[model samples]
Target: MNSSSDSDFFDVIVCGSGPAGLSASLAAVQSGARTLLLERLPGLGTKLLASGGGRCNFSNLLPEPEFMAAFGRNGRFMTDALRTGGLVFIRSFLRSEGIETVAEDGFHCFPSTGRAASIRDAFLHAAQKRGLTVKTSARADEIRIREGAVEGVRTAIGAFSCRKFILATGGTAMPALGGTSKGLLLAEAVGHRITPPLPAMAPIPVDDPWVSELAGVSLPDARLSFTAGRLRGSCRGELLFTHEGLSGPAALSLSGPAGRAWTEHRDSFRLILEPEAETDRKIWCERIDDARKKEPDKLFRSVPGRTMPRSLAARLAALAGLEDRRNRELKNADRDRAASLFAGIPLTVSRLSPMEKAMAMSGGVVLTEVNPKTMESRLVKGLFFAGEVLDLTGPCGGYNIQFAIASGRLAGENHTGTLPLEKQG
Candidate 1:
């Protein structure tokens, strides 16, 4: 915080310079508030510059309903925000700023330049053009609350008063990528409940020795089913086996709840990996049976299917004690065991990968305490929240970023403590 700013106070102050913070600052400025954006890092969007392997999956093409559902039970909290600044708005906004986006796979959107720096630079250039005062390396140490409302913020350098403040400090995932808990701490000091921040959108490490051997193996599509707290379900998408465990859309989508359930419950849960939507024990059994009559001399492992990775098939076959046997040599029990292994391989996750490896976190300021319509705290007037700092975690794609932009915009635009009158459509 610069004590030498022409004024030490502003109408709106947004903390953290990630996607949410940048968006909040822009929206506040546009809403006619004298706004200031603060960043703890040396510059803006350090984490965002590293998102999507630097490609920056900014948003997606999912419609409102399906987009909201991707976030599970608490997704509805973002209804207003999403409506205010969903994909259409985001894409148009980027285009207005000379940044074109493309949904390369017809879903996950990326900047046409394929560089996250382009997106970050767009925000930087726009902020400069709009005269939104942004101070870097200014970590908010304390959020000063007057009575029951927000008053100002104090950093090690200086204290800047504000009529309202927004917390977009993001989550504790990828600490190296500008992730920290300062925003959560500040919220806690001012009477906000914070969920235990857990790693999400990252790989889950397992102790299965055979899984480790299939490090480079990729499944066409994989399904990971688990029960974690209120998020009990399955995630289906592409999957890749790693030296430690599973990584890819499927594993990453389920990692959040699975990790939380494993640590919180103090019990190891089964991580079921089904290779495809139609795959089941019966299908595997039939495949094996057909192979016995058509190619009886072939190895049992080769009977899994043409899509199954050779190494993974062999490993699963070995687990069923059928690796070295011919398809014709499989007895009923052997065939059943092989079918089960092929259908859904149960892998034991020793532990979820650390926060340093995660794309985002599962926990944050619980959604209940904040008003979804305005992104404002129900407990504290003039205090608002956006982005990963809230208890909203999406799968490994463009969902989280889209929420950040939308929620940040809502929080910033509504900093005056009221919703904007929706124009008659």
Candidate 2:
């Protein structure tokens, strides 16, 4: 490894060439800055290729308020960025690069070709045409700062100087795709505080024995709520019973809150699972009574399946102490108990799945330390942050990628000095 002098210096250096760094580098070069993109991996977008099971859920088309709300408290910080056409800008940028997108369920967006490689290749082609220098397999060792301002970065390849720098190394999730604590370490070195990172979009473990019995059973439109005293977190989507616990969209989205609750007090965490439309326990009881009248010989275990999976129905019947009886043998009290179980089946949450299995993580460089408008560090001039490296985590359904692209776009577009926008076809 050899150090580079002034001749090789760049106007801006973007670290990590995932979605965020790619967007940042493109924005910087398009702004007429001599930009350099540094990636530790041999290839870019490694984790990205696995998103949406390879279909690549690039972004969502949700309206601004609804989309931002998915991020919880930090969502407010993205107001100016999203309002400035962040999501739209990314989509438009892709379209300009000849990559088309299709919307799923009128909200989730994916590449028209259903390939993550298309987006990755588009970025590489654009960077090359704009003369952006990308160094793959070059790990950034340290961020150099001079008297509270950006100086340059020390990488495994060599030390290089830059007028500005952006850290988009991402959070410590999906370790197989290069996720690590390197970003957190770099931020700490630069006088930034990082919140304790936890698994966000990840599966959750439960203490119930039925979890294993019902493994592979999936419930669509199930509502899961976790409560720790007064603090509560909830999400409604598909839920899956796993050998160890619960999974699928709803459980994964709710893991962040549940993980925090468990940390507050392990035994305080409790999860309630029910059909999304479950509201009145009495109504369920009445439905059961009607079923008993319609067919007195019907099996009690088969009753709950009308609202949930047959396996779940059996479990609920057993929980309510009515599984051994037929509908005709059930007394009014037994009917009520069975109905109540269906309304809200309580499950003890053991903990969240390990971070390695999570899609994204909660916690990173604290949001307050960066200027949300430009993603530039408020404490360190000429230094910026973006993507999962920041203290922002969103629910499943393309929100994370949207934030990465938006934050990176803002950082690169607003980089200081005179510049010219690269002409596009």
Candidate 3:
């Protein structure tokens, strides 16, 4: 990377150094454009270093549209960006950086070394090799605009002018990683509309204190459905019981919508746990009856352990008021109650965890304020945006990072008036 002492004006200035910002800087430099990457922290990719449990699920190997579905409501917003710079482009970019990747579960793509720092180092190395200036410990205080166009940026060090500016500052997730709402604030100052940010992929707090008792307990191969009044959606994945509440793939996917619905309707919601097949409920009942007949002294909790986790079985039995009842002595009322409890476990959501603890943040600069084709700001010339700063967020498992890289590459390539692949080294 270019030394901090260099005072030369750059053709492009990229703020933030996460995946989006780093990708943009690298793309700009590869296009033979003099580039400057500004990072507030002393180091780069702080959030990327923490992603995927520090392994960095870089992208998904599935088809583009199918992968876009994971974004829920705002999936379409990324179509143009992805079309210009998709998984193929990302894999090739990593390959050029000497970071080989392998796909797992037909979705997640990770470095061959299975390390997050490898991916970060690849981008940092590529940017440095291309003569991109990286300024660490340099925070962008404000965007300097002139005549409705980009002029330069005011940093902690001093004012630096540039021909083109790209704001790749990430959203407000993991504030400890240097995420601030400043990106939105900066966009708003330039006449861009800002969506109200909300926490996505976060754990939901359950009202039951018993949930904390089952901390560290995990339920694999289970489906969780969330319902608030009438709106309902189901997500099937592994569920993890945490000391705070429910988390894991299933819980995190539903957390955003559940949190929003719970806010509008504060009463309660239903989280149906369809562990067994719906059609097999009758057969399950028959099996339970046969077991009861054979083991008269056995408790109801003991029987459910065969099908469910021990902690979950005990919790369900307790909820049905059959904790102390012997299997053979269970009445029709008790049997029906147990079935109801098993089918649909009621988890009263108290609140969503803080944004700092979320996997991703929903909401950012409104789509209407940016040109979808080029990812350039409609209000400011020579200025672009990509990544979490945009009003789009996807589910866990590499979707967010995929879009960040795609959009970053698109913005960077377009900034220099060239296609992504054509500009690549």
Candidate 4:
């Protein structure tokens, strides 16, 4: 990267040094545009460093549709980026940079070195080698516009002029990583409408004694369903019981629906731990009967223990009022009660963890106002946006980072028309 004392003006100015800003600046510089990247933090990619619990699931190899579905309805906006060689380009770019990638679980990709710093270093080195200037500890407070056109940016350091500007400032997710409303604020200043951001992909706080009681217990896969009047949704993944409530991939995925059910319909959420195909309440009864005929002294808790943790099994038996009851002594009514509880347990959701605890925020810069193909703002000339600043969010497993990198490259490549656009039929 260029030194902090480098020149103030450039052909393109990228604000924020996360994945998007880094990709944007690198693209601009490679296209022979004089580019400058400004980062508010002393270091770069703080949030990226913290992604995937610090291991950093940088990208994924999921087919486009499955990848897009993770972001829900707003996912359609990614069509141009994904189809116009964005994902392929990123994979190729990383390989060319000598940064090896490894795919886990047949989809999620991470640095072979298992360090987020590797990705950050690769980007910073490439940008600097391509003659990109850099400024750390510099904040872009405002976009300087005049006569209904582009100009420069007002930053903590000073005003830097640019023919074109790209805003990759990100949303309010993790304050420790420097996520804030700066980019949203700048977009609004240019007359762009911003959808209010809400926390997405975070843990849900449930008001149940058992949730805390079962803290630290985890289920590899569980089905989570929520119902409140007209709203209903379900997600399946690993579930982790926390001191406060639920976490892990399944809980994070279900948080959105749970939030909606509580906010819109005022309903409680439910979880089906290790859900079974047999739901007639006879399956569990028969299993208990068979075990009783063999052992003749098996406890009721042993049935649930086969599929769940021993502590959770004991807790469920207690909740069903058969904690001390033996399998042989369990009446038909007792078996039915335990069967229902195991099928789907009810849990009261008080609220979701605050935005500061979320992995990503769900809303920003209305998608329609920006060109998906070019990552440029339709409302403002010579303006572009990318990353979490957009109105899109994806589930766990590297989808979010993939979008950020792809969108960043699009914004970088198209910000100044240096990289030619594809011919449309």
Regions of candidate 3 where Cα sits further than 4 Å from its true position = 1-8, 104-106, 229-231, 264-297, 415-425
Model 2 scores worst on lDDT over the 10 consecutive residues at 416-425
The Cα error of candidate 1 at residue 369, in Å, is 0.3
lDDT of each: 0.83, 0.82, 0.80, 0.78
- Cα deviation of 256 in candidate 4 (Å)? 4.0
Kindly indicate the candidate among 2 and 3 with the higher TM-score.
Answer: 2
User: After TM-score superposition, what is the CA distance of residue 145 in candidate 2 from its true location, in Å?
Assistant: 1.0
Clash totals for all models, in order?
A: 0, 0, 0, 0
Q: How close is candidate 2 to the true structure, as a TM-score?
A: 0.94
Instruction: Name the runs in model 4 displaced over 4 angstroms.
Output: 1-8, 84-86, 267-296, 415-425
Give the alpha carbon lDDT tens digit for every residue of 85-174 in model 1. Answer: 788888888899988899878989999999998887787677667768888888889988888888888975578888688999999999
Give candidate 4's TM-score: 0.89
Candidates by TM-score, descending order: 1, 2, 3, 4
- State the lDDT of candidate 4 residue by residue for 235-302, as single tens digits: 78788889988888887876764664566666444444434423436777777767667755888889
Write one digit per residue (lDDT tens) for candidate 3, span 1-425. Answer: 33755355777889999989988888788888878899888888999998888889988777877778777656777888898678888778789878788876766898888899898888888888988888988888889898988888888888777768899999997799877898889888888998778788898778788888999988776677777787776777888888998888888887766666666666756656655424245655675687688987988888777777888888878888988888988887777767666766767666678998887887899888888777899989888998999988877778888888888887887444642222211
As for candidate 1, its clashing pairs are none
Task: Give residue 78's lDDT in candidate 3 (0 to 100).
Answer: 82
Rank candidates, lDDT, best first: 1, 2, 3, 4
